[model samples]
Target: MSLVGIHGVSLRYGDRQVISRVSLQIETGEFFVIIGPNGAGKTTLLKALSGLHPLIEGDIQIRQRPIGDYTKKELARTLALVPQQVNADFPFTVAETVLMGRYPHLGLLAVEGKRDLELAEQAMEFTEVIHLAGRRLGQLSGGERQRVIIARAICQQSEILLLDEPTAFLDPAHQLRIMDLMERLRLREKITIVMVSHDLNLASTYADRLLLLKDGTVENIGTPREVLTREQLTKSYGCTLLVDENPLLGTPRVSLVSEKVAATISKDSGEL
Candidate 1:
């Protein structure tokens, strides 16, 4: 069965329709990436999948059951969402923050047991944040905080992970590290992951499949080669794009074609 299924889903905020009748299915144990230009409802779609926003139309199912049927705590046990940014003014320690992920599993008025502590520590180690366990969350850098948040999600022990712009503020090295970590976890645990990113190259590199959104609808959905074609991308993004193979990974590489350069090439070719 598909891990997630969305059918004719639409969402709106007041008079603004952010998502149109979009539908897609995500298979279990696959790495999926969602990509699009700004205001294409990439984040909104992620939010809808996470059940943070109620759908105005259609239905979403996880594991053959309706998503809305799961209670918040029940849902937390099945999926976790890592947002683009997280901020906190309180002086919570890194360990404390990570321990919160276990809330969904804890009994009423219960405290962290030996297994829970071990799980939290293991998650911290996986994300390389164990050394900073004593540090205050408010004092960490953006990259550090991002890792901490992911560690917390790992501690949640969900089968599916949803991430939005996970590499936004991180440097290149850290970005690779985060992706590598996620890939490793997914492989080892048979977890399913869906990420929303603007980095086409990164998406092409790691995603098993890509979903391209345009104006709140699916423009394309397929392997990188099929979805990242120049014709499809140009129509979806409303701009001329150059598509080529990435020399290292043999996946589709996308480049923006400047109008000035195109015009010059056109004139030179015409004069020949």
Candidate 2:
């Protein structure tokens, strides 16, 4: 079954509708990425899928079942969310925070048991944050903290994962590392992964499919090479730009024109 389905999903805040009849699917084990500019409703869509925000219209399904059919615990078992930011002053140790992912499995008022600890430890190892396991959230660097957040999601052991701007605070290297870890995890665990990213290059390189949103609507959905093309992106983003093949991946990569080109053209026009 497809891991996720967003069918004719529309969302609104009071009178302002952010998305209109946006539809897409993420097949089982697919690495799906959503890309758009600020206020394009990428984050809002992710929130709706993660059940943080209720759908104002239409529906979202996971594993062929509507989201409303699942209880909180059941939903947690099916989908995990890695949010955008982590505060440095939260005070919880990295391990402790990750262990919280196992709460869905715990009974009421129960403490974390050996298996939970093991899972959290394993997640830390997978994220390469084991050494920082004891470090407080306030003590970790931006990248380190981001990894810890993903480790928590790993501990959730869900079939599908949702991440909202996960690389927001990290440097390029750390961003790549987190994305690489997600790719490896998907292969090893058969998890369907969906992420909202502003970095078009990384999104195209990592995602098996790309869902492009523009001004609260799904402009296109297809493989990265199809949706990230020069023309499609130009129309969606309202910017004229160049598209070229990524030398390594041989996929379409978007490139904006250099300012010098426009400057030179203007100078020539003035002379004319």
Candidate 3:
């Protein structure tokens, strides 16, 4: 059975439909990515999977059980979500923040035990945030804070990890670092990853399969090669795009064609 089943799911904010009958199955240990232009409901869909957003249409299932069936604590123990923007205004230490992931497993008013500390330590070590354990979250860089957030999610010890634009504002090095860490966790811990991203090349490189949404609808869903075609992207993004091969990873590489470049090519081809 698939780890997650999103069947005919549709969601809305009041009367405006934001996710339209989107159906997809995510398998165990798969690195699945959702990509689209802005306002395409990528983040909304991710929230639906995490049971944060209620569906106006169909249902979502985790392990063949309806998402709504799980209690709040049960859902927290089953799925961990790392949103795009984290509130790090508080003066919580990195270690303290990471240890919060274990709250779902603790009894009422219970303190963290040795096992909780060990898990948190392992999570921090795996994400390479152990060195910053003593530092406050508000004192860390964007990259460092991002890693700490991911470490907290890892510390949750959930079977599924959902991320929303985890690399949105990081530098290239940090972006790659986060993606590589996610890949390592997928392979080593067998954690299922469901991420929403705007970076097509990064999605193609790491995702076992990609789901492309356009105007709150599923435009395409398949392997990167099948979904990242020039025609589909041009249609969905409403702009010219160049699709080519990534020499290093042999995955599809997508490049945006600016208006001037596109016009130049059109003029050379006698289409202008």
Candidate 4:
């Protein structure tokens, strides 16, 4: 069964519908990327899938059961969300922050047990933040803080993870590192991952599948090789698109070419 499936899901703010009848499925063990221009509801769709926003219409299912049917605790156990930014001010150590993931398993007045601590430690180790376990959240750099938050989500031990623009503030190198780390974790744990990314080329390289959205509607869903054609991206972004395999990565990449450049390239290839 699919780890997560959305059947005509919709979300609205006041009277303006942000997500309109979006249908998609994230199979188990797949890294799925959702890409669209700004105001296309990519983050809104991620929020709806994470159950942070109530659905305005249609239904979503997790493991064959209705998403809305899951209790808060159950939902917490099934999926974990890693937001793009964190404004944490607590003096708690990184380990303590990660241990918070075990709240759903803890009793009302009980503290985290040894098993919980161990799990949190392992998550830190995997995310390469073990050395920062004792540092305060306010003391870490932006990339380090991002890693700690991701470790916290990893400690949640959920089968599905939803991330919204995970590489927002990092430098280009660290951004690629974070994405690579997430892809590795998903493979190692057989976890289904869904992320919103503005970097279409990185999304193409890492995601096993891509879902493209346009104006709150599903534009296309397929492998990056299929959905990331020059025509599709050009029309979606209202800009010239240049699709080609990266010489270094040997995978598809998207470039925002100027109209003049695109016309020249297109005519050279006899496409125009």
Write down the TM-score of every candidate.
0.95, 0.94, 0.97, 0.94
Top candidate when judged by lDDT against the true structure: 3
* Local accuracy by lDDT, each model: 0.91, 0.87, 0.93, 0.87
Q: State the lDDT of candidate 2 residue by residue for 156-229, as single tens digits.
A: 99998999988887788988999999899999999889999988999988999988888899888888988887
Whichever of 1 and 4 has more TM-score, that candidate is: 1
Q: Across residues 1-272, which tens digit of lDDT does each residue of candidate 4 receive?
A: 77787998888966878899888888998899999988899988898888888898889998889988988878888889999788778788888899998877777864988899999999999889999988899999989988898898898899888888989888998898899888888878988899999999889889889999999999999999988988899789898777898888777888777788777877899663
Order of quality (lDDT): 3, 1, 4, 2
lDDT of 3: 0.93
Q: Give me the runs in candidate 1 sitting further than 4 Å from their true place.
A: 269-272
- The model with the greater lDDT, 2 or 3, is 3
Model 4 regions more than 4 Å off: 259-272
Q: Which candidate model has the greater lDDT, 1 or 3? A: 3
lDDT of 1 by residue, 1-272 (tens): 78899999999866889899999999999999999999999998999898899899999999989999999999999999999888768889999999999999998975999999999999999999999999999999888899999999999999999999999888999999899988998899998999999988889889999999988889999998888888888788887777888898899998877988767866888320
Q: Please report, as a residue range, the 10-residue window in candidate 4 with the lowest summed lDDT.
A: 263-272
Evaluate residue 57 in candidate 4 and report its C-alpha lDDT on the 0 to 100 scale.
85
Displacement of the residue 250 alpha carbon in candidate 3, Å: 1.6
TM-score of 3: 0.97
User: Lowest lDDT 10-mer window, candidate 2?
Assistant: 263-272
